[model samples]
Target: MKGRILLVEDDETFRSFLQTVLEEAGHDVLMASDGLSGARLIKGQQFDLVVSDLKMPGKSGLELFRDAMRDADPPRFIFLTAFGTVEEAVGAMKDGAFDFLTKPLEDPDALVRVVDRALEGLQRSRDYLALKESEAGGLPPEELIFAGSAMQPIRKLVHNVAGTTANVLIYGESGTGKELVARTIHLLSPRGGGAFVPLNCAAIPENLLESELFGHEKGAFTGAVQARLGKFELAKGGTIFLDEIGEMPVALQAKLLRVLQERVFERVGGGKEIRADVRVIAATNRDLAEEVAEKRFREDLFYRLNVFPVNLPPLRERRDIIPLLTEYFIRRFCRLVGKKLKGIESEALRAMKAYTWPGNIRELQNVVERAVILAQDTVRAVNLPDALVGAGGPAAAGRDKLKMVERDLIVQALEQHGGNRRQAAEELGMSRRTLQYKLKEFGLLG
Candidate 1:
């Protein structure tokens, strides 16, 4: 694997000789006269590997290595030492040097061999990462919309880790756009060219989820008529987004952990082990820490998936985004529904901003879509839900009143029906599904 390499040696002749050999082997080599110069070069540029003398006048090779290690993606290091300093060279190896060489270079080809092996390993790693990224295509960073300080850190974290192979766990309340964050990470990463496969663990039935994740052979189960590929297989060389991961069954969590640990898994009722080349991004609204403490989740699995955790701020906390989101949704729905709406009315924007968004971005989206359909020209207060605008007070402060009213109505309905969903739906004059959906939306499922 040909790569840009940094060569640090105080001896001018030796440095020139090494640079000649490396360049002949089709590798671009940068020469540094001393350890300090090498360290400076590394900080200013990206190198695949660093070859430096063990001893230097200023900033010894070991010191340079220590400094380089502070970077998020440090270059691989190879140290050169004299005959009597082999022990010290070995010690450098212990400090994470790629490999160490002795002075008075014998069989000059040995250096080439070590360089080849190191470059080969680096190539394989890049290939694996590239395979994943190529399959999971993503949106550009500028395409993601958010106008709140709360999201700045989250966006920065996404950018920082996108180029690496770290597994990410996204924590947020329902409707907080956890899946959106996952897609954003996948798009921004090196593996953006790959597919972004998403599966909601809570939405699937317990019996079918396993097959959905790991596939099944013909006649594997009662209804199995033919062999089928699973999400992991379909998402090969890309990303598999597991949504509502906290709801994954404990029995299945063990299997998921094994796949993560070994990077291999067998399809349901299949004997052959299949290699899993996909990156797994899991998200959930529930607190996995609490779930682990209560034995509902596996502690080991939690740690494995939580290598990098991103927490999304709730809609109520990032109220500043409401107007932007409102406007965005307005334009989006207007185009879709062929509405001639010019813009959102000031009163409508104030009402939306004041209303505590229990349903988050998803709720805001739904409201805007509904408003677009009802709007004749501009979205006004009348186009919004009565719950948002009917409260007596400045529209901005009326969110609390709306919340209180909604809570009281739900509580009364539940009490009237003794918590029976069917009767509650009938009494509330709404579909049972709508009632259940609202119950979940309002955080009353408990």
Candidate 2:
């Protein structure tokens, strides 16, 4: 994770030595001869971390740090001090300095380690802010996200790959919550403190996709009124979620492949190379393997992105959790509409579980919201969409069929758990009391 660093020191030789070390470690280093000059630079530019001498001519390092703190976003600070001023450096640490290095450095590795830690802390701060913004934007709770048995293994896989820097390729049908899974991975990983930038490749036009990914300089194109940061730059030290990656044009795919291979990219019309320094999590509804076989997608790019593959089972395969999801949506919609409803009627829940959710959870949420608006007290069969209720006619045989299907689900869950009622109830996303009542109603308790 390379960062922009500001180096402030009074000794020219020491400053040059420190600059060489930081640049060798892949950081972009800006130099200042003294604290006054450092203060001016801090006022003009942004840096991820600052390394400064404890004492300097004219303005002191402590004064510079205090002045920088007035900015909206201040950089992390590390001070260099002699044996005598070690106490002053310790005082600076208490005042929010990152760390201090004793003069006549014992080992250069120590400086590298401290700088890396400070930059990582900065990334985490950024990630925290981004997470709060996402929460305010209405991200669902983790329980609701991994609500069904089908998602249990996926949850584990997500946790496993999140800690590493491996590129992830998620395969699932549309509306199967791929982006949500990507966000979860970002939040759990070491880089969770960074931004999570998402871009839908299929949504943008081919002519503009390059600019969207790599940004563009002022006057780069006809509509380029000013320079703009692209998704890659915006997601620096974070994760970039490329949704519908298969839809990326072949030409743009080549550029993306280069970025992945080299960890560097040039803007749409710029000559300077910018470091990517970001984790990639790409998702597609299409079968990327088949796309690669047919020469539609580059094989190299596929291999690069498919380091870790995650498959999300559709909602139809996780039908047992329909009751849980329905209850969640009902309560959420009830609150939004300012209505106090008992809940969904049993027949409506049965219809939901019996029907194959071709549109998955997204469709279910929309249906529940609509039902909440239409229902006077409890969401019943009539409140549901015509397609769901009309499939089962108003006859005893249809009701009997729905009841049998519900009973089969309970039996399967019980059998799968070796008759442990608690485990079975959890797998079915229901309370133990509800499961017990169902078992008796279906004459399975005997």
Candidate 3:
């Protein structure tokens, strides 16, 4: 979507170049040379996002952000800094900058993409703000689909607690928008302006999770050829959302607790301690209280993170939200695949309502996205996976519940044809676009 942009910089040539580039991308551009003038323009204007040079004649970007936020609605700021001044830029990001670009600006394309992303962020916040005010209460809970009385208490809870910088422990079934809630907290909190880094504890191997969180010095391990910065250092003053915190190994739990308490961690095989002022937001599908009582999880760390607890009900529990979620996913996935199907058919909706989603919202999203991708024309119940089609097939939809799994047998034939879609399609008993579309659909986009 197109939106307004304000660039605050002292250099005339750079300012002119940016304005021209941004305008060509279909954005309305506004410019200011110094911080004082920039502040005045920002306070008076309704900009989607702001890009400003860090160092200026009068006030700096930091001063401008401080002043601009005084207004009820302040545009998100992106700082511009030089290469040697990255430290200052990081400080700005921690202070509330959306994302920063370094000078001399090398990648015009990257800059445009960053601006677009920032604009999308602005739109989401604006939408959430409007929805929270217009609706019964605050914005809907993360990964939660429902309506009416059931959502009010959760909405009020989310709104009341989001402002605090305390460590938050979220309890929810898998795919319940735990990360989304973590993100909403970051978006609405004092640390909302900083980076919101996320890590899946279950995804990472136990041996690697520590190094991933705390970084590693060069040659610390067999494959350690470079000194790598960890997630905590990268997040700094923002937030680190540890998804599936319960899955973390028992040994690493001690270190994670120390980091949570002291905000300090040592790189793998390094002596120096790195202090991060970052906020901790941990989420788990398992019952941490049970884990604590069973002596599996560290009581200290659990307490530290459990300062503010937010629990999200499973999709089945929040039955009211199913319709909303179904519509949202259909629209979202259709857009992703470059399709324009209207809404779900009544039969499809009925099938979805009847299914018990064990994998929860994520499972629902994948099913909808895959159904859209597989559908020949508009969405229909017949287009869904075979497992989802017949109640006799499976107990419930397994993961995505694909109707057909593409075997390596067909893929082998396709490769034997030297990447010729026509030959592959003829051999595989399909059309060229159908084969080509499958390849493209499976992330083989070229």
TM-score to native of every candidate shown: 0.61, 0.62, 0.59
**Model 1 agreement with the true structure over 1-446: per-residue lDDT tens digits:** 68799999999999999999999999999989998889889999999999899899988898999899889878888889988778988887887778988898877789999998887777656544644543233211233344588888888888788778999999887888888778767766656657889999999999999999999999999999999999999999889999999989999999999999999998888999999999999998876886797798999999999999998888988988888787777877877778778898888888788776778888888988899999998999999998877533465456666767877887798898887767888887889657755775576866
Q: Write the per-residue lDDT of candidate 2 for residues 215-293, one digit (tens) a residue.
A: 9999999999999899999999999999999999888889999999999999877999999999999999776886786
How well does candidate 2 score on lDDT at residue 444? 89
Model 3, 1-446: lDDT tens digits are 58788989999999999998899999999999889999889877788788999888889887898888777878888888888778988887786778998899988988899998998777677546644542233224444432534656766777677777788888887787777777777766666657789999999998899999999999999999999999999898788999989888889999998887787889999999899889888999776776686677988888988998987876767666777887777777776779888778888777777766667788888888888887766678887766665543345444324523564545676689986656888998988546644563343434
Top lDDT hit = 2
Greater TM-score among 1 and 2 belongs to: 2
Q: Give the CA lDDT, 0 to 100, for residue 368 in model 1.
A: 86
**All models: lDDT?**
0.84, 0.88, 0.78
lDDT of 3 at 34: 87
Error of 3 at 27 (Å): 29
Off by over 4 Å in 3: 1-149, 390-446
Candidate 1 lands at a TM-score of 0.61
Least lDDT summed over 10 consecutive residues: which range in candidate 3? 134-143
